[model samples]
Target: MTTTHQERPLAVLVGVQLPGVDDVEHAADLAELGRLVQTLGFDVIATVSQRRGALAAAAVLGEGKLKELAELTGGSGVVPSGAPERKNKARARRAAESGEDDEDDALGGDDDEGDADGAGSRGARRATVVAVDHDISPSQARNLERATGAQVLDRAGVIIEIFHRHARSREAKLEVEIARLNYVAPRLRETGGGGDRQRGGIGGKGAGESALELDRRKIRDRIAELKQELAAIQREQSTRRALRQGQRRVALVGYTNAGKSSLMRALTGSEVLVADKLFATLDTTVRALHPEVRPRILISDTVGFIKKLPHDLVASFRSTLDEALEASLLLYVADASDPTFRDQLGVTRSVLSEIGASEVPSRLLLNKVDRLSEDERDALRLEFPEATLLSAKIPADVAALRESLIAHFEASMVEAELLLPYAKQSLIGEIYENARVLSEEYGDDGGRLAVRAHPAALDRLRSLLAR
Candidate 1:
């Protein structure tokens, strides 16, 4: 018999020391896991991890450690100095039959062959689910599950869960569902490796009525349904894009929660939801800007980016992220207060490039400079010589933004004048709305007028020109 100090709702932070991810990132991943566990109503009282060589696989942890974790997660591991963690004495008795004796007493080591089934092996309420800090290959996930008595998932899966929690709109929900299904589909286990269907938990996991086959079928069907729904949504988005192409679209692109939404609201006076969380703005929001200052240059606020985003997920969200594709100009807003601002900038560019917006002309808008010291602000100006140093939260900076935008738009616009008869008052109205009016006047006969419009808006105003 043995006693184990068992903390309820504990999670094991597993890590595979892979290349391109340093120790700082490994720490960050663990922190993110803590946050997600909290969100899922689980308290992380401990983290168990092992480092292995770069070439080493097989979960990067040994089998003995796995067995130890399995016992604890299975509710047969030790607690305190001499007791089990099961609140239910009946459950504790149930666990004891599963060969949960102390390591010194349990057949000398982890290799002892003990064949015990059904009656007492399961003790933990939440079955052991393995969380890895790295990307897990499909085979890797399957293999990890076999090696450890738990369901396995990687960084992307946890992120998708957070996105699921934050998603609000139909479009956003569909996008998240599509991403989640895509991420999960390849990882779903077909074989009942742990035990059998009757021996597993729900979602075909941990051995219960919601068997592996049932879980696989649900995942596959959901994947099909989400694909169909996303395709339809993509078609609708395409239609809307055609209409918007008539306007010069400037998409505000940046890192997540870098005040892009706040900037959008400030510029267009549109009340978009602004929050402090990552990926707050999932949908692209377009706003009419510079009506009098610049013609046909509508501004859009798009979703933010993070480092090491899942490639398949990015590919799936390409349609929703069309702002980068359709954008005539990208206002790359960066947070001044971020310590890794340069690194984040690189990541943003990489993500944009992956989404096929590499050559798009971008204005580096260094936002939140109000939080910086004067010396720090000077250093930033030197770093980004062409970037507009401003605080999106400040009205003065908003004015500076407006000036920069007007300048950019005017630089792109081709000025042309068209003459219309006074009877074509409707055409004049079109000119006023679609083009920045330079001058308006009547002919000597007062039956005609002359107007100037930006070339970008001329296509949409063509029919009105006929009037």
Candidate 2:
């Protein structure tokens, strides 16, 4: 009835409570890190936490705590000097040879477990990975790997891995690749023998570049190529977005696993990928609001944001986040049942601000209220008086949300009269598609119609009528 490390990769979570971070925030961050590790298929076995003014530059944890952490991973409980460079180089070369370097095999290779002396006698069950709650330096990661005898992944690494795995669209895949390459470029190490050199000089007399330098250069070149490809894809996306400029667009932006996808499915009736994992949906999916209201509202589900989302990913996914930036309205969704939903909402706002989406008109939607008790719901209502509290599962709640979306856009609509000529009767579909027809009267020469639509859409309709 129990799972072993062999069945699933075992991970040990590590956290350091720094200055200005209270216990609640620290605990929440560590819990989020555990979810991220689980998202990568790792079963977190234990957590090592420490309170310090700052994270230790060398090992991230104090000496005693470091050793304590090592015991759980069958390590030697000592941070050695740079003597393991040769062994690490060999491991890197083997990983490269097996094509594992380009994959999400950071915690692979069972041979790398156990103590540094190749002694498997440390009876404690070893963890295959150590996931840090905060971002650490490359050197710090290497030192921790040496001290704990496990693959080390900081918070950013875990998030990037999840994005890499969940990316489905070409644009998302390219963006994830760029972010992954940027992450790996700095962590490249010299492989092969310690003194082995690759030829970089014309005559071969001068010392050539190290394997590490070559790898870094390759990563840089690959990242550049990926960016160019991503740019091309983004150009196509821009064109498509431009076409939707006259239509009403409502974007769903929120923290990961905040039930955005569930609400998205309910409101739009689109079969988008819905899951209970971090970064489950990375692709930007645009679906028309179901029951399909006049002046159809295009609802977009963008990639969810998280606390400490990597800057590289933010920059790479800017095109994707443009869905939020350009929306006529934004729905800031959150799980009201979660105790940390407030913090999660703050993070979502911070990221939106970083992407310049803060100026967009938005509504707070506290989802999953079905899980909350009556007292909890009342407390939430008092705290967020203006927010819409509803669960995605309830049909009436979904209908209310859908109507609210329609009403929000309808508030800005202007009434207009269009005369559809008999010769251009085919244009009737266009009018019905772009506006809510209030009335229509057909005559011998043309049909007189009254409609309500956004100003931009009406202008477009007038231009089409003129042509």
Candidate 3:
């Protein structure tokens, strides 16, 4: 068998700047999209943006803007050779006008002319994909592909692609597939004019079904099957959840690549997979918080949320997010150094509300504080008085977070005195496992124990003694 390794596809990122939107924020959004494309294993050739009063329904960008973008991609719109220097000068002028340095190269790498994927040897490189930073409609995507002669992906499409690539566990894979199919079903098209396919079966009823309709049917059926499988998984997860009902749970919820996994590892003292890419951790990882305390606390790191996260993706991943819903506390982690961290925090809250975890007790975690200046840190403190600012890499910061968590759980504990008979000596071990034994006195019967424990555990001990 011959194994073929394909080169990374080149992509051109497009963003449309609209009225009433802050230019800096828009640029940051485009920069994040470029990062997402990089995470998706694409070599971004260029990042392009256009300012317009509003988005065009046909292609988001106007004809001239689209042509300008196509020129860079070596598409049919306009060849870059005609005004290559002019284009470069124009980009420089735009950068100057924005009061920012030539930052476009920061997206991926320097723009160079060459063949892409062995399409041409010496001509201008053709981008294999055009990634729009906005969530364009399916029709818009098709229009862009037709005009640019490349595969087109809107923001949601790119994010979903990243999810599909990063998903590892069975539940993550199933949920990602369901979300991908939902996105793909609407974009399916019939290449040939063959609507006259007749079938007598109930599934292919009404005298016929077009190729597009059949494809959509298959996607719907696949989605249903995946959902059914996910339901079974959810049941298993629920049972596991029930087993740990009395234990305190802290769920880390945050924007993608905001150091949630790093914080998880820091707090749990476990070998968690940490990456700087968006959506690096898809599966929920639960670990007992290290330096384990009485009435153990479990911390779970969940799939991160993003601005404009697909509704279907959220719906598909709801079961995985039940960890947050059932959590005793939620840590709203954010990159405190990022200028847009506040907005990212808002996005996280919105997703939490959508998942019915709005009422869950939440504490803002201003993570990655080491990247911020003292002035910036002061400003963040002023903005979010309740937020805990810490760098996951700092030992003292992680220790503070750990101690804060312990304090939170400790506040909920109840002190109780229990009497055990001599035959019930085995119960002493259970108490030591689940509670902080303050005092113990040996008696003729057995032992009198004074301990502070979670109310549920205290009740359980009382019941066990009665039995």
List CA RMSD, all candidates. Answer: 11.9, 9.4, 7.0
Report the backbone clash tally of model 1: 18
**Per-residue lDDT tens digits of candidate 1, residues 1-467?**
89997654545555544446666665555666655555544554345444333412444344454455555445332222232222434533644776542122222122222212211243434445666667767765655565555666676776677677877767778888878877776666546454354654453444444455667667778878988887887889899987666566789988776889988988888889987667778787888874334355688888778666777667767886787888888989889887767777888899988878989888898888899999999998887799888887899889878877777666756666566666666666556656666665666643332334556567667656664
Name the 10 consecutive residues with the lowest summed lDDT in model 2: 102-111
Candidates sorted by lDDT, best first: 2, 3, 1
lDDT of each: 0.66, 0.85, 0.82
Model 3: residues with Cα > 4 Å off, grouped in runs: 1-7, 78-123, 200-206, 419-433, 439-448, 459-467
Q: Which candidate's TM-score is highest?
A: 2
Query: Looking at model 3, which ten-residue stretch has the lowest summed lDDT?
Result: 103-112
TM-scores of all candidate predictions against the true structure: 0.71, 0.87, 0.84
Judged by lDDT against the true structure, how good is candidate 2?
Answer: 0.85
Choose the strongest candidate by lDDT: 2
Candidate 2, residue 266: how far the Cα is off, in Å: 1.0
